[model samples]
Target chain A: MTFGQAILEALESLNGNKMRSGLTVLGIVIGVAAVIAMLAVGNGAQATITGSISDIGTNLLFVFSGGMEGGPRGGPGGGRSGNNDRPLTLGDAEAIADPFAAPSVELVAPVIQGNGALTFSGENTTTSISGITPAYFTVRNMQVAEGEVINEEHILGRMSVVVLGPETAVNLFGHADGIVGETIRIEGQPFRVIGVLVEKGGGAFGSEDNAAYVPFTTAQARLIKRGALDEVDVIFVQAISAEAVPLAVEEISNVIRARHRTPIGYDDFTVFTQQDFLSTFETITGVLTIFLGGIAGISLLVGGIGIMNIMLVSVTERTREIGLRKALGARKRDILLQFLTESSLLSLIGGIIGIMFGWFIAFVVGQVAAATGNDFVPVVGVDAILLSTGFSAVIGLFFGIYPASRAANLEPVEALRYE
Target chain B: MDRVIEARGLTKTYKMGEIEVHALRGVSFEIERGEVLSIMGPSGSGKSTMMNTLGCLDRPTSGEYILDGESVAEMTDDQLASVRNRKVGFVFQSFNLLSRLTALGNVELPLRYAGIAEGRREKARAALEAVGLQDRMTHRPYELSGGQQQRVAVARALVNNPAIIMADEPTGNLDSKVGREIMNLLLNLNKELGTTLIIVTHDPNIAAQTQRVIRLRDGELDPENNETIVRKK
Candidate 1:
């Protein structure tokens, strides 16, 4: 018989038992849908993380005053022992900023951070406060929505002026606008809000919108007096270009090592470029994506087995029908093709429906994530769709072999006699 | 007379789990074109085995059997299937119609297996009309009476215009009235189409309708009642 005739016969048989066929299709549907949805969610999470990391600023390097020997350091000022005692100071930031010493380093911002309770109009909230120079605004890609950012004049004069992040401004005065000139108390010290930073989304570190920025000299004199007088917590460095980052890192590392009087191998500092963080995160998220897809694939396998089970039952149930067909001069290949066509059609239909179902699941997940203030959008790539459909089809064919062969190998006389 | 089937020293041995059961032993017969024959024997008398071998459903262990000028005993499985498609048509006692198919679809099965794609529907329709089932072409088997279903089976057996038609207890499942109707339909088709007909049955009345009756005792032919009724042509 022709392939077309076999397909038609298969369709007729399947249509004759709609409930059984539907249930069998549903198994594959769940399997393919789970695979697609899981992969999309995993991909979306990876994209969100990497996108936020890239948003931190291009061609930038972070310099922390600690070696890599210690196990898993927390954010700055969580306290570390041993080689971490040597702190990065304002002098080191200035040295790295010098063009003659580090030509690839375009800018540097040394920062000292602390937590403080801010009160304005009887509304109180505790937030992180960072003492930063004017260069910090440029190096960290911070933009001002009103007034002006901390300038060299404010740093030299030790002015009690602060810049509020958009979220912080909203928390204090209930709005971001018209509050730039208002005065807010930080740890009972009255400081004028000279500027408000524009809304930048949350990042790998945390939401920059929830913090406050002050002049470096003011922070050193009024708050954060525990560390050495000129000690800074972290230094943000901007390279001339993305390609210049490695050279910039080398220059900064040499300058810091000379100033700290440490040898190359035993330097008490760690400098990392954005690429380093990106590669590390990519590896982690790639594994996570595979892990999720793998788990979903197990369900797909189970779906294939379900198809096999149903096909076997169908073969047995239609033993006499098979015998009749053989008696009607259907070749073994014809019977095999007929049953195989039925199973593959079942899986293919399930695969198409699963794709739509999976896409819907991913869309719902994205919507929910967005509602929770996350920038995650589930990514349903074409590769995922193709992989799932192709795999399911193969699964159907693989699982169908035994049953189809069983139907094909049946003796005409025996099958016809099988009441 | 043109010979349609020529069997010599036909033997069929079946192994029932290491116990050799010879279902057919040196049974031989010849059937001419347009001949009507009946195979009648009690249970365990090799009647079923003879029918199966004659229908080309099973190969003989030792014999030379030819059907419609093709040597069938030495043919491969696929070759035998091809021969069966083109040379032999079958009607079973249970109606053997696919429950899901309409009468027309059932009639078209043999033509489909014969690889006759184009004009299959027209041929099937003509066959159904010949069997007086033109009005029931769109009805499924369950919707038809036993006599009507058997007529549809006869139509299916005639669709491909095969060399021979084999009916195994074709009226076993029907009442006397329906059985007689089915028997008349088969005999009339043989008379009109000149197609060879072989019916395997235990009913003597059914055998009496045929031109010849071949009876078996155990695995061999029973010489007592074996006779060919000469038809006045």
Candidate 2:
């Protein structure tokens, strides 16, 4: 029989039982929707993680002297560089900051660190102190929410000045504005709060909003009490131009290594630009999203197997029809193609509806999330929608073959005689 | 004789799990074009086997059978199907109208196999009208009476304009009055269209109405050893 006739007949059968067909289609819809929705959320979370890591700019670089690995106690002895103690120092940052020395380099900031009990009106809490030069604010995108930023005078005089991050200011001083120009004690030494930092939002590790900043030299002298010989904790540097970042980093690394006198492989310190952190974060989030979405895609397999099962039932139910068509001169491929087309159509219709429904659901979820807080929830987009719908179609086309071929290959006499 | 169907030394043996049963044995016959032939026999006379062989729905175990210079013995099943679909049309005892399709749709079935598109609806309407089922074209098989359903089946058979019409008890499931009506429709096609027709039936009255009757008993022709076969009225 003509393929058109066969297809029309199959469609009529599907149309005859509307509810049953709709319910069958519903299976595919749910499968595709779940896949899209899960992928959207995963992508959203991944963007957030990567955004937090490199929001400052890829041209910015950081050198943290001590992380999980602890460095030497007292410096300028026999360090990993054979000049001793922890590797980096303020001199290395000053060396790179020299304009005529490396014109491609822009700003550099020395950093030191200490942690102790911070007190405000007898409300004591443990707080970390980050000692930073004046350029640290611009390099890390930290703005002064109130009062003045740490200036050269604070560093030169070794003044007891401090900047409170938004979270710390609110917790101790009651009002973020109240914290500016107030005195707080860190390890029983009083430091004047000169500025409050802008809110930097949450990150994978912790809230960037929670911390205190002070002049590098004052912090080094008062709290840390380390001499010029102590290894530098960190140095923040920004490239002279965004385009020149890679070259600038390479030159800085060369200059730093020459100062420390260390071989490349066993260098005691790590230097990486913000872009490196961003890409690393992106890779991590991408993998996490795929893993989550892959688990959600299991439903498609279940739905596809369901189609195969129903098709097998249909073949048995219409064995007589198969026989009649065979007797009327239908080719095997005609029958096969007819059944396959029917299955694919079923999935396509289901997928279309599912994508719309999934988007609606994701929108609703975003609305609910927005109600709770101001966080923007990620949702289904073109790629997710197309991928899911196409996935459903592929599932149908892929799984629909066996039963269709079985129906097509039936012996006319055998099928005719089947009760 | 302008022989359109010729059977020589035809034998069909069926295997039912190691027990062989002879269904048609050494039966030989020839039918010329435009002949109205009826096969008359009781149940188990192997008449159904002969009908199946004639329809090319089953193959012979040992035979030399030819249709219009083409040997049926060597023809593949697909080739046989092509011959059946093109050269012959079938009307079943049960009216076999595919219960789902209307009268016109049923009549349009063979045309579908023939790949006759472009105004097939008009052709199917015309064929149904020729069977006197023009008013009943929209009625499904169940909606139509037995006589009407048989007429629809008859229209399906004629729509292809095949070389021969094979009806296996065309009125087997009908009442006596409706049976006569269906038989009259068959007879009219034979008379008016001069179409070759073969029918299998146990009714002597129906067999007597045909131009020729071939009696089968126990898988062979009755009272016969190389008997003369001829058209009679």
Candidate 3:
């Protein structure tokens, strides 16, 4: 018989036991759906991390005072600056930005950050306040949605004009728009809002929107003046290009070491590039995705075995049919093809349904994340879809062979006598 | 008349755990094209084994068989299948219609196996009509009467126009009246289409209707009759 005719016969036989077929395919459906959903979650997290890191400026490195030990000091809400441990200063930032010192270094923005309660119109909210140079906006890709960004004049003159992050603008001024010229009190010091930053959403460093920006000179002279320590919390450095990151990191480390007169292996500072974090993140999520896929694959394997079990039962049940077909001139290959086709069709149908269900799961997850203020968008990779589908088909093929061969190898005379 | 089947000293033995059960022993027969014949025996007399050997379902342990001038003993399993498809048809006592397929679909089985693509449905319909089962074309086997199911089986046997039609106890499960009707149908096919019909049964009455009858006793030809074989004009 033609392969098409065998397939039609297979389908007809499967249709004869509709409930059994449905139950048999359920295992595959759950397995494939879990795989797809897991992949979606993994890819979505990777995309979100990549996007957030890119938002922090490409080819960038962060140099913070204090050693890599005991966690990151002078970080956000990190009280107690490393004043005794060779703290990074504004002078060091300038020296690193000098082309003669580090040619791979492109731009450096020194920042002194602290938390403050800003009061406006009798309403107050706690936010991180950072003193930065005019180059901070360009280096970090920060944009002003309204009014103008801090200029060199504001930095040199130690002006009190400030840029509010969108969230800060909305929190203090009750709205984000038309707040460019609003006056707000930072720790009882009056400051004029010059611009509101465009929203960039929440990420690894928490909401950038809840923060505020000011001129470095003003923050140094007036706000939280620590005498003689003259320390900046962190210095953001940009490399000339992505390829220059490692070179820039090495050069910056060398410059800081020489300038600090620190000995080898006893360095008091840590420099990390965005690439390092990206790769680390990728490894973590890649392993996680594989681990999840493996777990789901176990279920898929079980599903395949279930198919084999059912197929074996079916072959046994249809022994007489096999004999009858042989009597009707069906070759061994014909019987084998018919059973194989039936199993594959079962898996293919399950894969299709699982794909749709997985997509639905991802959509619901995305909606839930958004509802929880994460703004996370789940991405369903086409590779994941194709891989799972191809895997299931292979599973069906691999598992279907034994039973089909058993059916093919039946003795026609004995089989015809089977009750 | 062309010899549709030629066998010489066909022997088949079964070993039931160190005990040799000889199913057939030096049984030989030649059937002509378009001949109507019956193989008659009681249970355990090896008539079924003879039928299996004649149908090419099982190869003889030590003998030769030539079906339509092709060496059945030397052929591979695949070639045997091809020979079966091209030259042999089988009807079982159970009617052997696929329970899942409609009467028309069951009738189309041999043509499908023969890979006759065009005019398959029409030929199947005509075969069913020939068996007076044309109106039950879409009925499944379970929905049909035993007699109708048997007719469908007969139509399936004829659909590919095979050279030899082998029926094993064709009316063993049918009532006397339906069995007679089936016998008349087989006789009519032999007379009108010149199809070779071989029925294996224990019933002497059924064997009497055929032009030639061979009775087997304990894996050997019956010695009671002086006539080892019979021929008819």
Candidate 4:
């Protein structure tokens, strides 16, 4: 018999018993749906993380003075440069920021960070107090939401002016709207909140919204009390462009090594760019997405088994019909193709429906994430859809062979005699 | 003198566990082209076994059968199936029409199997018309009466234009009036289309209407019984 005729016959048989056919294909539907949904969620999470990390700064590098001994490290640039014992100095920052010393370094800001209790109008809260130059805002992509950022005068004159992060302003002053110009006592010294920073959510490193910023000179003279006159914990460096980061890192490394007079192989410092952190995060999330996709594939396998089980039962039920077809001139291959076609059609239909359903589910998830203020976009790739549909079709064919052969091998006399 | 069916000492044995039941024992017969023949016997008389052997649905344990010039005994199952498709047709006692198919669909089955692609529907319609089932072509088996279902079976048997038609108790489940109508239809096909007809029945009255009758007792045709009867009417 022709394949078209056999397919028509199979479809008629399926149509005859709609409920059983629907139930049989339901397994495949669920299998494909789970696979697509898992991929969507995994990819969405990866996208969100990548976006937030990039939002921290553009073409920036973090230079730290401490050595992280061994094991796989985060991509080579941004983190806490050092502790107080072997801290970076203002002179080091000046040398790195000098255009002739490091041609690719566009800007550098010294950072001194400490945790302190801030009391504003009898409301006390513990928060991170950061020491930075006016250039810190430019290097770290910070913006003043309510008032001015730290000025050059504030840095050189050692003024007690501070800028509160959006969340910190709300916490210390009880309202972010009027927090600018308010006097918040830090470590028993009163500092005027000159500005409130704009809102930015959490990133891979941590949230910046809970920190309060002050001038590096004021922090050095009044609060930290470290013995060294020019000591700072970290330095943020911005490159002229993204392609210049590697060159900027190499130049800064050479300048710092000369300033410290450190030996070549035992340099006590690490320099990492934002690109490094991105590659590291990509590797981690890529492996996780595949692991999740693999787990979802197991359900597709179960779905294939369901198709096989139902196909076998159908062969048993249609024994006499097979005999009749055989007697009417159908070859063994004809019978085998008929059953195989039926199973593949089942899986194909199920896969199509599952894809649509999976997309709908993922769209809903994206909407919910948006409602909760997260930047998650559900991405359903074409490759994912094609791979899943193709895999399901193969599953149908693989699971269909035994049952089709069983039907094909039936003896005409025995099958005809089977009531 | 053209023999459509030639059997030489056909033997069939069934192995039931350790016991062997001889269903056919050295039975020889020759049926000429366009001949009307009947094989009648009681239960366990080897008549059904002989019909199965002649229809190419089975092979003899130790004998030879030549159907329409092909040596069926040595043919593989697939080869025999092809031979059956090209040269043999069958009508079952239970009107073995696929229940899900309409009368037209059932009738087109053999033509479809024969790979007659273009005019299958037209040929199926003609076959159904020949069997007086043209009015019921769109009805399913359950919708048709027992006699009408048998007529659909006959239409299916004729649609492929096979050389021989084997009817196994074709009227077994019908009333006497309907049974006679089925018999008349088969006889008319033999007369009008020059088709070979072989009817397997337990009713002597049905056997008496055919041109030649053969009887089987136990596993063999009894020669001493002189059971080959020629009907003059």
TM-scores for the candidates: 0.95, 0.90, 0.89, 0.93
lDDT tens readout by residue for model 3, A1-419: 77777778878888999999999889899889889988899889888887887778668899987676645454533433344456778889989999988999888998988888899989999999899998788888889999999889999889998899999888887789997777899999999999999998876678888998999988888774643466788899989998999999989999999888876776677888888778878899889889988898898899999999999999999999999888888888888889899999888888888889888998999999999988578788999899889988888888999999999999899999999
Clashing pairs in 3: none
- For model 4, what is the C-alpha lDDT against the true structure? 0.87
Clash totals, every prediction: 0, 3, 0, 5
Q: A1-419 in candidate 2: lDDT tens per residue?
A: 56567778768777765786787788888888788778877776766666667577768877654322444221222224334424578788888898766677888987776677778888877777888888988887778888888999998999998888888887787778856667999889898989888787776437767888888888777777654554467778899777888878777777777777765555556666777777777888788888877876888778888888877887898898777766666667767877887788778888998888777777776787689774657757788988888899998888789989998888776776676
Candidate maximizing lDDT: 1
| Candidate 1 lDDT, A20-70, residue by residue in tens | 999999999999999999999999988988998898866999888877765
Chain A of model 1 scored by TM-score: 0.95
| DockQ for all models | 0.80, 0.48, 0.69, 0.70
Question: Tens-digit lDDT track for model 3 on B1-233?
Answer: 68988889988999899999998888888888989999888889898888887788889899999887888887777777778888888888999888889999988887887789899999999999999987899999999999999999999988888888999999999999999999999999989999899999888788888888888888888889523446573
- Model 1 DockQ vs. reference: 0.80
Report the CA-based lDDT of candidate 3 relative to the real structure. 0.86
Give me the candidate number with maximum DockQ.
1
Cα lDDT tens digits, model 2, B1-233, are 78879999889998899999998888888988888888987888899888878877767899888776678887776787777778777888877677767888878877777778888899888878888987898998889888888899888888877778889988889999999998999889888887789998888778777777888888888876222345463
List model 4 lDDT by residue over B1-233, tens digit each.
89998999999999999999999999988988998989977799898889888998888998889998999998887888888888988999998889989999998887777778998889999999999877898999999999999999998998888889999999899999999999999999999999999999989889888889888888887666545687643
Q: Clashing residue pairs, candidate 4?
A: A64-A81, A65-A81, A76-A272, A77-A272, A77-A273
User: Which residue runs does candidate 1 get wrong by more than 4 Å?
Assistant: A71-85, A121-123, B228-233
Q: Give the per-residue lDDT digits (tens) of candidate 1, residues B23-138.
A: 88898889899999889889999999988888889899998999989889998777888888888889988889988999999999989888999999999999999989889999
Pick out the ten consecutive residues of candidate 1 chain B with the lowest summed lDDT. B224-233
